[model samples]
Target: MSEQTDTAAVPTPEAEPTSTPAPAPEATEAADVATEVAEVAGAPEAPEAPEAVTEAEAVTEAVTGAVTEPNVWAAPPAPPKDRRGLFAALRWTAAVAVFAAVGTGVAYGITQPERTDIPGLSTKDDGRWTFPVLSRPALPAGAPVPQGPDNKDGTHYAPLTGLLLPAPEGAKADDAVKADKDGVVSADAFLEEYTPEAREKLKQSLEWDGLRQIAGRGWTTADGTRTHVYLLRFHSSGFVDAFKGCDTNARFTGVSALDLDDVWSKAKNTQMNSTTLDFPGAANFDGTDLSVYQEVKPFLGEEQTKIGCLRTGDVLGMVIQTRKGEVAPVTFHQSVILQSQLLS
Candidate 1:
């Protein structure tokens, strides 16, 4: 019993640190019995075994104490190494690259040529009047297009009135032409464009020529340029060729003589637009033959007149433009082209 008491007291110093945790009741009872046994037997308290607690155990106890109450006293870990400098440098490099690309693009754009210097982009509008969108009139159900393989005689089967070109945007209608609801005017009304003596001759020619109908439209533009477009439809293409109403020998009311338009001759030489005409006018049309004329210089009554004659299929298209000062070639050519499209 005395030996047991001394042995129990030998481990007491090591158990002192473990007292922070809950002590077993059996261990306490055993301790009490060993103390009573020691007092009754009059045994001496054993000296503590210093070697029982080596350096390893002491370190373990300290580490355990620190880990148990970590939040209470442990200093925060050192912050992760700062990387904002490296990240900032990468961002600056990317921004510089992007700006360099954009700047290069702008510099290239600035050094390029002007739009007008380019071949296809070199077009600009020259004083041409704006006409409505021109469309061909619809043909009758069973009729073929004029001059087609099936229509060898080149007969236009559509209504003559629908084939007449409408007036331009700002032009006021001329009431002098006297076209009926069917767009037909009498031979007398058509002859009014010629001198009284020439009218008599043209009227005789029209009466003998198989003239089927005459459809006319007239308008005066804002610039005081008067336009009269007339479609004289014949029985067939043969009759159209035989008619002499719009030919070079035809006489106009006030013009002394008519000659082939020099502007038109220059336009034909350039293939389409003539720089001499000073405007971009499409002066030619396929499937339609043209005989364009202008009144000779040394104006009669200080007025100029220009005429365009189109022979399309079985129809003879006549365009007359008169202005006090001078007739603009561009407007005259535009009117002829628009009229030719409707007949073609």
Candidate 2:
């Protein structure tokens, strides 16, 4: 008998039975490789059930010749673990710390004074006079300074009294200079520096020459040294040169005759620094002409006299120092240098 075959209707209970279960899926080669790499790299253990599902899917795909997707998607590679934000925060913190330190330093510097002004922080002390701080007076609105390119005649437009050097500290004033409250003296007062016989002639000459004004300052130190400084301002530099009061032929009251101060020339040449002769301003006597003279032997009185003549621009400066035994050269040089600096 020929039977018609219908595969869909036939009962294949012996081929596959529902009461019997299929074996669990085995670990695939890909799962074994992933586990070994994870252990070596210190990664957390993966779920074992997902591995079994992947193996089963792979087997089905091979047997049925159709692609089967894996159960686990591997979480899309975890997005590469972004760390740019953490580095940016660290950099900002470092920048803030640097700025704060700089701000603190600036504040401290603004509040503190100079180290030289402090008592213990001052520099080494030399044998220098304690004089007040020196500052040039303000000029007239349209006037130029002496020796400036605009002022060809080298005229000093500032007040003659303002150009005078102030007395040093701990000095007593002298009444012999005959200076007024404004430090101004008369032609007769300035002529007192010469001998009695010369005063009348000098007075007549001062009135004829273009003598504008005279400013005088005198002080006595604790060591009995008398210092007298006089500033003679003329109408122009030419008149300053014509004044004979400070020339080599000039005659002082107490000094019989004048001789060139060899000590001054030697000190200037050697930049003298000795126990007896110390010249701090020896190298700084520019912008002026200096002539120093000492009293000849057999002085008129028991005291010795020295003269310092400084010609700067339209002014003639005379510094006279007198002492009982001898006038200190150091003090005389200091006075001349300081006066020249003011004129310059």
Candidate 3:
């Protein structure tokens, strides 16, 4: 029994601990390994990103103004629409000139055909001042030219050369004037040469049948140069005169001494401007200064005739249009000498 007690006291050889609980350290180590493996398996990979949006934004900012705005352009305002005045007319005229310079006809196509002919004809080809040149009479050296015009005896020659000579008092040239066979010659025969047909035609055209009948008488003349002179009667007086209207376009206007202005006050109020005739009287359309009155004002006495006329308007006037300057001079002695005895 004692032996059995001692054996019982001594540890008995038992089977292994089949149902023993595991230690806490081993359980904690297993949990740590499982946590590590779970973390490794469930971690997310690096993500694939969006590509061109940033570069596109930079390019958009570079091209257009704003990155967040629309790209359409705002248009500019147009010119105001209003009625035109002088400046506008000038502008339009300049534009038309430009178009014409470019070989266009849109501007001047609106006016009348008569206006196409410039008044003074600055252009040489324009036919405003034109006429048929009368042919000179052909004579075989000295063929004994006759004394009278057509041998009619109605006309009388008022001798002007006689006025220069010493004459008897009260024995005037006008008193000696007669229709048949007057001994003195006519002054007009020296200025112009004329054909019988042209003389007759001009007489008829100017309606001077009385002067024609009178001039038809044979009168002795000095110079032989032929010209065509037309008789002109003054409206203010019954005084008759003649001029060479050879250039049909050149015209002459005569104002009477009754229409003279004493002072320049009221006269300056009227602008004597003609497109063909210049104010203050320039000779040519281009600009050649003409005026016997202006140049010789000091020579003409204050009481002398100061008749001023302009070529611009309805009043007809005279222009010689001959190649020669001073075709008709005021006087051979003094340029501005007002012939009180003649023009008056």
Candidate 4:
């Protein structure tokens, strides 16, 4: 057998080399699925999930170093404010307020009155008056007689002067008769012109109690007779009627003969003889007439005095004439008639 094997080896071909073959497709597929499963289930435990980072850790890391994680979550930044738009809104509001204030001021100015220019009279800053203006009253219409010449140039008395009795033909406006428009003589001052007893009686009379205004004038006749006239305005006609009672008896007239007697009885620095007479043309009028003699130095002759009083409506007039001789009753009657006509 040995001789036979040698002989066969000498003639046999070299045996072929053996090699490993590729795995089957099913086995490779199974092995790949097992590896994927193992990676999913274990996967090195995913490094313990990095211990879930919080907002504080994120902020701390950001402050300490530059952030590296691209997927890190955070809140978005706030949008920029519009400063120009805010300023524009504030400017419009201010403009509207200023316009409203100006409009209100203009409306108020339009309602005020215009300023006036006058001496001694001034307008206030608000266009009101500081003092009232004074003017003369107009004359009443349809007078019974012509009035006296008006003294328009006279201070404060021009209006009243037109109602006074005219001076003698050659007489002039007397400065002594001039007074303030609102008379200077008060009730007490006027009473001083009468005797004590007459003053006392007048103070108790109705006319004196209601007296309102008094104006007086002095005149000299062409023949040198001195005359003084007094005008008294009472508060009402009833006061005038009470003063010169509504009676035909001259003595009953409250301001008639009895008043004349009292006045002469209390005269000082004079010895007087008096006569009370019924005034002619005055029977229907409220009037009285009186004649008196005043004694001067023994060598000098007695001074004659005549007086008359009359009332028309609420006005009472008195006329007194004095000279060296007895005065006529007609003289006082004429004077009273003229005054009454002016009053009417």
lDDT value, candidate 1, whole model: 0.77
C-alpha RMSD between model 4 and the true structure: 31.7
Instruction: Give a tens-digit lDDT track for model 2, residues 238-325.
Output: 8888888886688787877888877787775676554334434556655678888888789888899889898888889899989898
Q: What is candidate 3's CA lDDT for residue 5?
A: 42
Alpha carbon lDDT of residue 185, candidate 2?
A: 93
lDDT per model, in order?
0.77, 0.76, 0.28, 0.47
Model 2 poorest ten-residue lDDT run: 73-82
* Best candidate (score: lDDT): 1
The better candidate by TM-score, 1 or 2, is: 2
Tens-digit lDDT track of model 1 for 230-335: 9998877788888777867887889878999988887788876675444333554658998899998888878899999999888999999999988988888878
**Any runs in candidate 3 off by more than 4 Å, and if so which?**
1-197, 205-209, 212-336, 340-343
For each candidate, give its TM-score against the true structure.
Answer: 0.63, 0.63, 0.18, 0.37
By summed lDDT, the worst window of 10 consecutive residues in model 3 runs over: 335-344
TM-score for candidate 4 = 0.37
lDDT of 3 by residue, 1-344 (tens): 34444444566697886654443343344444444444444754322222223444546675776655321121222323343464588799999988777664534543444443646433432212222231223434433221234413211132222111121222222321222343332324412333333454554544442222222111111221111111222221111223233232222222112222322223224442323222122222221111222112232222222222211111112211111122122221111111111111
Off by over 4 Å in 4: 1-162, 172-184, 204-208, 244-301, 328-331
**TM-score-based ranking:** 2, 1, 4, 3
